[model samples]
Target: LLSDGRAQGYVLNDDIFVFLGRGKIAGLPVMVWILILTAVAVHILLKYTDIGRNLYAIGGNDTAARLAGININKYLIAVYALIGTVA
Candidate 1:
């Protein structure tokens, strides 16, 4: 759709459509690799990083997270942007 949702919709190029729909690595589909890679990366980030701790803290209590030196607004904005991009 257009920016204001005034148009019908968007379309992907045929080459790109076929490339992603049919491309494989070693016998696995491209999407499978993408999913696995994203899952692993997110798991590592959320389970083993200070940013993850701050994010959790923010989720629990914004005031406490802020007092603890976690920039709640930054993380909240970043999370929303990431989600919007993915969606």
Candidate 2:
């Protein structure tokens, strides 16, 4: 959109759409702030959450994880749903 200017025709080429446009929060781009905040949140979740631990265990070994009483099928479905939503 920025490179071709096609978004301008639809009135969507404003500051929000343009990566270099003027709109900063605390001297950082809004997109950068969003990315930073998302990363921090994910880090915290993975570090301190039960689901996060379960996810790690599943990644290390599915058979062991299942044997250890983790619901492999449910977690796998949840993971796929999360991935689909994110993508």
Candidate 3:
């Protein structure tokens, strides 16, 4: 709705150019750092969190996860939303 049904994207201004183009830190581009940070965050979320355990359980068996009191619908929705965001 915010987009009003038209295409929406970055403005590609100086800040955008710097972040994705020539910007660097410690000899690595800013985008690289962003990717690394994102990866680490995801690792923590999927390795050390109760949500992660629930996700694994859901993956192994949705019915069992539901029986174990996990809200499979909410988890599945969140998982799909995350995947869509990444895509």
Worst 10 residues of 2 by lDDT: 5-14
Off by over 4 Å in 3: 1-12
Q: List the RMSD of every prediction in angstroms.
A: 4.4, 5.8, 4.5
Using TM-score, rank the candidates from best to worst. 3, 1, 2
lDDT of each residue in 1-87, candidate 3, tens digit only: 988999977766778676677788999998889889888988999999999999999999999999999999998999899978866
lDDT winner among the candidates? 3
Query: What digit string (tens of lDDT, one per residue) describes model 2 on residues 1-87?
Result: 566855444565676566545568888987778778778887887789999999999999999999999999998999899778755
Error of 3 at 47 (Å): 1.3
Judged by whole-model lDDT over C-alpha atoms, candidate 3 comes out at 0.90
Listed in order, each prediction's TM-score against the native is: 0.70, 0.70, 0.74
TM-score, structure 3 vs. true: 0.74
- Highest TM-score: which candidate? 3
Candidate 2: regions farther than 4 A off: 1-9, 13-22
Tens digits of per-residue lDDT for model 1 on 15-87? 8777778889889998889889888987888889987888889889899989988878889899889768756
